[model samples]
Target chain A: MNKSDNNFLGRWLANDLSEKEKKEFENTPEYLAYKDILKGVDKFERPVFDIEANLQKQKEYNQTYLKNVSKGSKVIKLRPWLYAAAAVFLVLIGLRTVFFNTTTINTNFAETKTWTLPDNSIVTLNAKSTIEYNDRSFTNDRSITLDGEAFFDVAKGSQFTVKTKNGAIKVLGTEFNVYSRNTTIEVQCYEGKVSVNNGKNQAILTPGKGVTSIDKSALNSVEIKESEPGWMQQKSTFNQVSLGRLIAELERQYDITIEKGDVDTDRLFSGFFTHTDLNTALKTCFEPMNINYIFKSSKTIELKNR
Target chain B: MPEQQVSVCDESIYDQLYREHAEKICYYLYYKYGDMEKAQDIVQDSFAKLWMNCSKIIFGAAKSFLYKIANNASINEAIHQKTVLKYKSTPQKTYTNESPEFQMEEKEFMDKLNQAISGLKEGQREVFLLNRIEKKTYKEIAEMLGISVKAVEKRMHLALVTLRKKIGKI
Candidate 1:
């Protein structure tokens, strides 16, 4: 038999070879090797499998665990799949627990609240502000979303990102204050370094450096002279900002309503207002803009152009 | 009288199928994985699995069903371990006149042959061992392995070719 014939050995093993063919094939050294190998292998004995013992074991297994797995119930056949499904469900719930635990802190009107983040960082939220952070994965990835304004004293660790409406600030470990209101985002870095992105422009700030992105114009750089934000010192400072924006900040801080009667609120006013006294606060806020304010009641004010 | 629908749920039919397929399935796993104890455990587990679903299976299909269960059970254990195949040696008559050199050569050749079989590829080894050791027909091996008779034939041919090359090297 020729080696090229793939079926030759198969046919030979099946005893399908003619006697003459077998005789010719047996003359080759290849045939002798296979014959010896087969002879040696056929003497090997397999381990005995005791059917009675195994059957008895299976019967006992069926009695205990199989629940008789037949006409009464199909639980046995369906159990592995159910367990698999249950495992998947538990895995999803586990993932949800780790990823979906969002902790939110909110401050009411005229209320300043200090919150401790999960990573031991501190966030002092200004009045009428909200901060949301993921509590579960805070250690590995430090990030939070802010609305309104807040002062963050970040702990030393990975890059901490403060996401806001108009811009975002990223820093390793630094004290920075972020304020997002209307179309402006202001970032003041008091220590370490920070990278500020206003979607349209990006800037890097060191200690005592600040950037304010108003509308779509270039970022306005300002010097932060205070060791902390002025609001933290019972005072709020504004730089070339509109009067209407000051009115909004005043209302938020004092929990009062203000009415502007025929006053061009777009006029810029640069000044500081104290939080200690309402009369001084309103006078300091509206006097420089040449706008007159009269307290209609304890919680309401009307501003008139002088 | 109702016509008989040969159900494997019947004790007699179950026993009959078990008797027929249990040994073949055990040896099938043994040849595939080279683990006798694991093969025996797999056989027992496959039989238990079969018993659990006995009421839903027909009698004629029980053989293939057992083979399929046995095959599925061995999927995670296809790692071929180097388990030396042991053969039963006939008691030698000490008075025989064969030379000691010839006897030592025979022992060496047998050891090489066993090693060669163990070193064959999983597919070729299984087919070769099942046929050579179990004396199962090519048709039976084809059905058990879920392949065509032609495929089994080609496997046997290639297996023999490989064995020749391996043993001939010495």
Candidate 2:
């Protein structure tokens, strides 16, 4: 019971006591009583856990955490390129608009874009097309320069003109499709009236009426009767169009390169094909004409005479 | 040895350590806080934190780290549950399905054991239970409580002496 004697018991339990002292301590009633208490405590169960379940939880945490880290690394890799691309784009836009507040929009191959002009005119640009206009003078001038195909729903206000290198198409509050590529230019009016002008001549186009030109020379106006272009609905429609031009259109729409391997590319082909399936489109274009085609890769194709 | 070198335990070692000490940690917190659910939650949280900083805590000292974090979590939880005090009435299960006579004797012994343990001083109670019930070594108790091994031994001795004084009367 003495405080001085308690230190011996502490050392005895820690096995620090000598063997004779342990033997002597074990014979005491107090040691036996303490052992009984410890035995009682041993009866009480220690809390347990399912190690397998907890380990499974740990494994899941690690997997999800590592996935996030990998995803974060990808984002980090893209960050610098995103900023650089944005900077280059802004610089180009600034340079283009430096003189007259021009807004230039261009779409790459296999891409389509739609934009609203400053005057609330909706313009849907086809693949590989560009439209540039003066944002500052849009309400006053209403003029746009087109390098490729675009469908326009002009807001009714003043005269609207689409100028190209080959010619220009002028309208007022009408829906129309204008296509200018290489030496060929085509303007088809869908709603109201539009006037097409080549370098040497001009023609008036009403709804379902259109005109085509080659090398600044105008062709006779023809009737189309279509409400919209096939490309707008993911279809490529050709009416007695040349194979070379059709192949060029397919290349732009599908972002692929095609080589004419000893085939008459100048032959006229007429057919329609969906844009979602490239193999079907190729079949629709070449199979009916008895031509053989081979896809060298996903991005390259070759056509030969059959 | 460099602390970093000692601390860098791979996943397998950490997993082994978790398997070895996780239940003891849970029971330790449960006895201290009197809430088995809260104790298990704190143990899980401590393991999560340990894994997050596995490279910073030495493998040899991981038990101490687990105890330190588990203790802190229990303290915070104690403060939060002060208003509830729901586990205060949680009676320990003393007997399972057994004869009425055997159950009565078991309950009486369990009541005496609980009373003797409750009669001990706080330090002695912790050291004794962690050692006798949770089966922790004196060195481990010393490291976990940030005390010397002598202190743990003294606490264990005093706890046993007190328990003997309380239970020996019967």
Candidate 3:
């Protein structure tokens, strides 16, 4: 009689009526008619359908769809500007691959690195040092460009060459140390022979022999009985190395920037400092030289004359 | 429009939706045209269209999209069949392994039911078939037909009343 009753009757025909409503509606004439219609429609059978065959057709359609997707992405034509940008990017990448085949290894802060080259030649790089070389041509050329200090144990094969801005060290197959920094070059031959070249001057060095070239003019060779450099064993050793150079090495090992205030950094320092502890490293470097040092900030250290 | 870009429905979800609705859609199409094989083809094509526009159509809206496409396609097929002007034979009775008397009663009941349904108005028949055969809810039918739920209930009530009157005579 009402809208809700009418909806109830509709739901009854749909079999959507609840149990109570269904029970109440069962006695009504409309419910009986709905039941009769339901019986009639229930006998209407569904045409037999092969669901498996339908799914198979869907699978086949999806296979072609995947093929079209892959083919679609293959030839995405961009705008002319995008094409030009892509072309330029590709050329830059090609240039990097061809000309800049150079691999440069750098150590920062208190970090030390020991790398075995492709030829099995071992090179231990001290803190703040860098060594660059063309690995692709290393087998044939066995050469490396060096900055700062590195101890090398060259593998026996061809001529091993270490080039620096200050000088060049040429050897056959040997264990040696080369320290090259601004205006100062030092080469120490530990196990084998080394030929050092600084401008027109050249010096041949044998075991326990070290050479120092200052400003491309003064060439001094000294005797060192030690088997390997101290820095290689986590200690910094210098035979008459300058305070400025030692401070620079300290900055690299501990990731600090150092500033000198009224301290003569050019003065020579001859001592060994441990690489592990920052406080101990600073004490060993400055105590003997009588230079006072303090932390300016977390990342800075200032050194002043006592 | 901006919201549709975020819900990029991947193919796996699309496949899931396909498996879930394909059977009901096939049945709905078959009920509309009374041709099972032609209905299957239309359902397949409609699902293919859904896949082609999968990225643009959000996953939640996909069911309505599928039905819309199938409905349009079925309409076109009906028009095309009408132009051909070829008379189609009534669906043949399938063989059942029951007794002869039982089969005779079933066939008689089925004939009467078909007659009752064929006598219905097109609107009422469609609403009834979607509700009973395809098993769509009244809400879903209303949504598909762009009518209110009350309209769906009214159509169903009228269709049932007409079927009762027609089949009661037999």
Model 2, B35-64: lDDT tens digits are 567777787778877877777777788987
Please give the TM-score for the first chain of candidate 2: 0.68
Which lDDT tens digits does candidate 3 get at residues B1-170? 76455442575676677778888788766665666778788888887777777678887788889889998998877774521111123455697578999867766766777777766765687788888866789998887678888888888887887887787796
* Tens digits of per-residue lDDT for model 3, A5-28: 545556665667778777766777
Q: Runs in model 3 with CA error above 4 Å? A: A1-92, A295-299, B1-170
lDDT of 1 by residue, B1-170 (tens): 23257777777777777777777788777787777788877887777777778887777677888888887778856544555555445456769788999889877887777777777777887888888878889998898788999899999999888888888886
Model 3: per-residue Cα lDDT at residue B62: 88
| DockQ comparisons of all candidates to the true complex | 0.41, 0.21, 0.14
In candidate 1, what fraction of native interface contacts survive? 0.66
Best by lDDT: 1
The C-alpha stretches of model 1 lying farther than 4 A from their native spots are: A18-20, A64-306, B1-5, B79-95
Structure candidate 2, residue pairs in collision: none
Query: Candidate 2 — which residues are off by over 4 angstroms?
Result: A1-98, B1-170
Candidate 1 CAPRI classification by DockQ? acceptable
Please report how far candidate 2 places residue A257 from its true position, in Å: 0.8
What is the iRMSD in Å for candidate 1? 2.2
Q: Which pairs of residues clash in candidate 3, taking residues 3 or more apart in a chain or in different chains?
A: A109-A252, A109-A253, A110-A253
Residue A143, model 3: Cα distance from true site in angstroms? 1.5
- By the lDDT metric, which is better: model 1 or model 2? 1
